[model samples]
Target chain A: MKFKQYLPASSSDGKAMVSLKDGGTLGDLLDTLGIPPDVPKLVIINGISRGVSNTVNAETLTDGDVVAIFPPSGGG
Target chain B: MEAWMGKILRVNLSYGDYHIEEIDPDYLRPYLGGRGLGSKILYDEVDPQVDPFSPENKLIFMTGPLTGTGAPCSSRYMVITKSPLSGTIACSNSGGFFGPELKFAGYDGIIFEGVADEPVYLWINDDEVEIRSAAEFWGKTTHETEDFIRAKIENKYLAKEIRVASIGPAGEKLSRIACVINDKNRAAGRSGVGAVMGSKKLKAIAVRGTGKIMLPDKEAFHKAVLHARDVIRAGPVTGEALPAYGTAVLVNIINEAKILPTNNWQVTYFETANKIAGETIAETILKRPKGCFACPIACGRLTEISDPQNTGMGSPKYFKGEGPEYETVELMGASCGIDNLAAITKANYLCNEMGMDTISAAATVATAMELYEKGYLPEKDLGLKANFGNADALIILTEKMGKREGIGDIMAEGGYRLAEQYGHPELFMGVKKLEAPAYDPRGVQSMGLQYATSNRGACHVRGYAIANEILGVHVKTDPLITEGKAEMVKTFQDITAVIDSSGLCLFVALATNFLYEEIQSLINAASGAGYTVDELVSIGERISNLERLFNLKAGLTKADDTLPKRLLEEPGGPKGDVCRLNEMLPEYYQLRGWDENGVPTTDKLSGLGLQ
Candidate 1:
């Protein structure tokens, strides 16, 4: 799996390659990355926003899927 | 008489006199001060077709009811006038101590009318007002002008308390992109509002007020304020991300989304964007985080550049100042193809000191660079090789543009005129006549429609659809899709209008779970107007329609509501999608209760009480 993380606490390099079982859910990926469940985040799976809320863990993930995680952030 | 000062100081420069006028109570709830109230005054007082530089044009400095009331991010004020660049209704909002200080000085706003025969600056110490000669400070930079004025005050303590809003040489020279600088750095930037002030030969307005703003229901106001503060403090975006990295945090995110405009929109992403991103600034030259009055987010950056090698040619090796906000970094750094953070920071300082809009100034230079690259602009006229990524050229051209010298003189007219002179208006990359900011709308589909319909030409803050389209704020929307974008754009625009009129920073909207209900509660307690959430939103619609009516009267037609040809026809972004403005505009007009030609229907105007 290809992962991009924008949270400073989660990943220092912002990009990572992870191995996941087939039919794994997004909750599994967050658990593996040691991301806290209560922290607000925006999860994008393959360029589409899965959710920005805490319930994004319900999203199902598959092999070769791209997941980008962003902290609550905005622009001017 | 709660929240609002309930008085306006009208200064007629031609006669060297002033008068105090009472603000009508009936206008307060609907207009709500700042942009809304100021625009109403402008529409009623000035002829729409009057030349922006003429003495007939009036410049208004207005503050909202929440201003100086200890409300979060209540440090904003609006400068309303006709834009010399776009000829549209200009209402440039700025944040600093100046707006609050003006309120404390016993006036809600100031109306500047007619031109002075000589350069002058206004001084208000409570009721003591004077139009002093500005001959000594006329050609000075904004910093120098402030210092000169402060030094002239015999009472040092009073001088220190005084907050001044002044123009630099750029405004004095009447550059189309010149902005008004307050508190030495914060600017009422964009739309050439400073040029209007310059035409009046009024250099600055220094105010020191000792009065407190009265509130009708202090207990209720405090209750609402404390709750809002808690919500803002807990927000992931507002409380943490913004205070930690400032607005430049978006540099990486937007670039990753492949929507960060680079090389003046010729490209959609910058490979070296990380060099100037917020993370890099935090790791490097950032001195500290700064905030305006009552601003918990503190998104402002206090930064310094000490490396001699990184500084631009003929610029200082060591300098400390307040920004290079996200727009500045993108437009002047990545958009101009120069990723040197130090150079970008120095250029930002120059813009602040010289009183120019960094967005338009940088976009104009980017246009010149493209013109030169295409062989349409001769090097003889430029006096140097104006190429993309030329840091020295960026700095040199910025200073020249401020002074209106050589090739900079042509650029001072703005990107539209600069490109039109070079025979490619299509290459200007703006709507109406004002240059667009840093976003590449081709990637964020709704932003294109936002840009097209903004009352002030091509402004992101007017309707930041990027919040939904890219950042996933409020609701996540597909950036590449056209479906439902029009309704989304209208809603964002209306909400934005309410925020702008409230004297609160738009960044507050980024807070997770914060919505119009919270805003309505704050406004009700602060102003004692008791508006419902829907009514507050309707007031925003009223303001939008009023400004649109003014623009239509100012000679703007449906045709002017458009993006650049490049955005519409040329493909860009990672997906190579062009901005489908046509797909969204008709629906937007319908949502706005406007006709197919983009004119507000009589029913819509009457419903909003504009009739």
Candidate 2:
């Protein structure tokens, strides 16, 4: 999973994608990466915005699920 | 009293007469200067039915109380007038040394009225204010005008202390989308305020002041300003992200969220959004970063594009300038389906040099591209193929728009007018004839309500509901939902009104995790005005209601407060969503104490002391 550096618990370099265990839920992946489940304002898995109902934290991640996490930052 | 200069400079261009007037305390109390004071004065003095270009229309330059007070990011000034483009009340603010210089010159604001027989510019050296002929500078670009004025004012031996606010050829031609450029790059860049200046034949206002700005409680003011700076520094957005990537950081984020408004908003996202993203710009064209007066976070991108061939663009093999801000990148690059960052950068430079609004100009071009793609516009008429992703054509079209030559005459009229001229009013994609910003309402649901009801005609800066809806600055809200957005929009609008008047950058209000109390403390300490946090919030609401009243009087009905049909009806993004404006507008009106028709009730006006 690629994380924007601004997000909490993301790698300092913001480019490393860690391999996760098979059938690991998104929460387990976040826990492995030390990211709090509630930190990201919006999470995208392969370009679609996942609502809270379909949050990455609860959804199980497959082998090739690419994730992008965003923080609460703004500009016009 | 200490924060405000407590005076106004009134200039009549027709008579070439200038006078200084003591600002009424009552006027300053409720309005509180800046946008609030400027809007109140515009509503009071100008007839709503008068043409925007007529001599009867007044142009007011206003600064906030914190301006020139050494407050962090406190160098913003507003240009308020009736917009020739949108026919709505226009208040566009710019940040540079000009605001502080005006305050230091012992005036809180300047009100320009009547029309000049010939081109002229205002020169202020302390109290010696004079109306000088600008016949020699009639055709100069904004950068040239500033350089010429500065050179004419000061000797090379002395330091450059003068600051200027000037218009360019775009303004000289009275393009409806012209902007007033300050410090060469920063602009009061919306609502055709520059056209208002051009109609009056005013070239620029150059000011030099050595006078000091006094703060009532200097210690408290210092403490408050320091604390505010600290708060800004502590935030992740203001402290780190902005300095690193500037505003262009949002390109990927918005694209990721699928709300980037690509190709005249026909789609929600662009395919090559990453090419023009902040990270890309930082890695490629960005040379350095800059900031306005006393700004702690330098979010301004001072960039250069040296590879024209690689950029796939026009003249200027090596270009150097500021910005191509997030809005500029989106509207000029992705929104037009031209992902060439250099092309967008060049377009941005043209807009700055020619004193044009990037959003308006680019959106207009995007609309033209859409028209051309649909066979409504012929390549023969355009002199070039304006197909989507035509980088070279984007550069040429931008230059033509700035010069207002050939087909650029129609293009210069702005997106709403351009779309209407092409026989497609519904394709305008704005409220009250003003073009929408980079955000697509179908994606960020609350932004639809914000743009629909904004007094300034489809401006995101008016409310910035994106703070809650997208960025979650204050709190996270479901971007796809309509519930609770009404209350959120109202609160954001009111708070934004306060911030706009308070002489602080809106970024502070957005990025800083604080409330009205800290802002009130800063204002009270600086001005010795005994205003509580609640009073400040009420004043914000009052200013908002006053602006709403102006728009209402100007013939903006509830019907005018609506999104484009596409947003209201069509599917958006991969999720196939649509803006629930109907679901939200009624709740928004109710929360605002407005009638079902969107007019504020008499009691609501009375409660705000606006009646």
Candidate 3:
């Protein structure tokens, strides 16, 4: 299985996929994703995450596992 | 008398008159104040047929009942006028300390009419008002104007915090899309209100008021304000995203939705969006977060752009300025097919300096670029080798537009007129005479509907339906859906009208008021009055109807409820489908209790208390 997330503010599209070894939970995957805790808002798996402890569905993840993350936005 | 000064400052330039008028209590109850109250006055007093740039047209700057009352984010003021760009009623709202200052100065509104014989600026201290010569400030930028006003006044007891709303060369040149800027680089920055001020020969408004502004119920208001600020600080949008990266953060999300207008609304996707994304700004250029008066959520940024070229190795000077807000980024960056954030920020400074609206400026530049590409507009017309992605064209033409010189002369006229002048009127992408924002309606269905019927001509603040379509706040609806958008647009419009009228910035409602019902509570807390969600929504409908009545008087008909040819006939993205504006307009009209032709019925008008 693989985990992918984007740091939108940095223009980092998270197009690079990370392969997770068997038996890794979302927490481990989130940890490996390496989003700094101090980075106020993170679009973790299409949801806002204040902490990296947010769980991802590592079990459902497979090769080419693509998850898009977004930061909070304003100025409409 | 607790918070509101309950007075109006009237300035007539043509006759050289300045007087103070007591506000009508009845008008305040129904309209609530700010943009809403201003719209009601414009609809009732002025003839709709009056020319927008004429001395006959009155420009009303108003604040809400809650303004300067210690209510959270109730620091915004509105500029209401018949827009020179749209030829319809315009209400552009902005956040700052000026609203509070005006309240302290014992006035609820400032109404100006007629043209002065020469350049002049308004000076208000408490109950005192004066119009002084602005010969020294005739050609200065907005920034310079503010500095000059502060320097000349030199009032030590006034706290050195005189808030000034002024224009740049663009407004003096009467560009259709000039903006009124204040503290924190906040702006009533959409329509041509700046041009109206220019036409009146007004240079700037400098206000200093020390009278304590109080809410009707100070204890209640303070508690409510605290709650609202907490909500703002706790919300994800305000707490995390905006504080971390400011408004420019939306660059990637809108691009992901594939709705970010790229290269003149032709492409939804931009490969260069990453280059100008929010994170890049925060990392490379962002210096510190800037904020408006009494706002805890300081989403504004004071930034400096330094690069390898500015390492004293290449350019002698580096660019430093206030922004590249999301709209400026998308409009100036992606829409014009320019991805450089530093370049976009520089252009923003130019817009502010020249008194231009970045949204309209970028959109017009894109229109001009499209013309150049089609060979309809010669390169010589622009006084340069004009093309998209050419940063030089963006920088120089902005200055020209400020001065209304050369190609900038025609470009300053706005997209619709510029296209009309070249005999290819279809090239213009706007509703009425004003240019559209960064969102291409084809991608976001509700936006298309909103733009089609917007009284002020293609404004986003009227109803920002994009949050639902793209950001998926509350409930996510498919961005491609046309059905039921009538209700969505109406609902969004009504909610926003209340927000604008209340004197709070919209960001508070969107990011802070996560639970929809909390918005009503917050307003209740500040006003010390209670209303069901229904009454608030009705206010929105009423404001819309009022604006419609004003526009009808301005000679707009069902024909005016239209999308540009490009949005209606040519869809460019994956679906290649044009906006079904025809299908949406009728439903929107029906929802607003209007006739099939988009005119407000007499009954509807009467219900809203319109004359």
What TM-score would chain A of each candidate receive against the reference chain A?
0.71, 0.68, 0.42
Which 10 consecutive positions of candidate 3 chain B have the poorest summed lDDT? Answer: B307-316
Q: For every model in order, what is the iRMS?
A: 3.9, 4.1, 7.0
Residue B40's C-alpha lDDT in candidate 2? 91
Residue lDDT tens for model 1, B490-572:
88888888888888878778876677888888888987877888788898899999999999999999999999988998898
Q: Which ten-residue region of model 2 chain B has the weakest summed lDDT?
A: B308-317
Candidates' C-alpha lDDT = 0.88, 0.85, 0.76
Q: Pick the candidate with the highest DockQ.
A: 1
Ranking by TM-score: 1, 2, 3
Report the C-alpha lDDT of model 2 over B210-279, residue by residue, as the tens digit: 8888887788889999998898887767877788889988897788778889888889878788899888
Off by over 4 Å in 3: A1-14, A18-67, B154-159, B306-319, B512-524, B527-532
Residues B477-520, model 3: lDDT tens digits: 66676888989998888878888887778777666344435556
Residue pairs clashing, model 1 = none
Kindly report which residue stretches of model 2 are placed more than 4 angstroms away from their true locations once superposed.
Answer: A1-23, A30-42, A45-59, A62-66, B157-159, B308-317
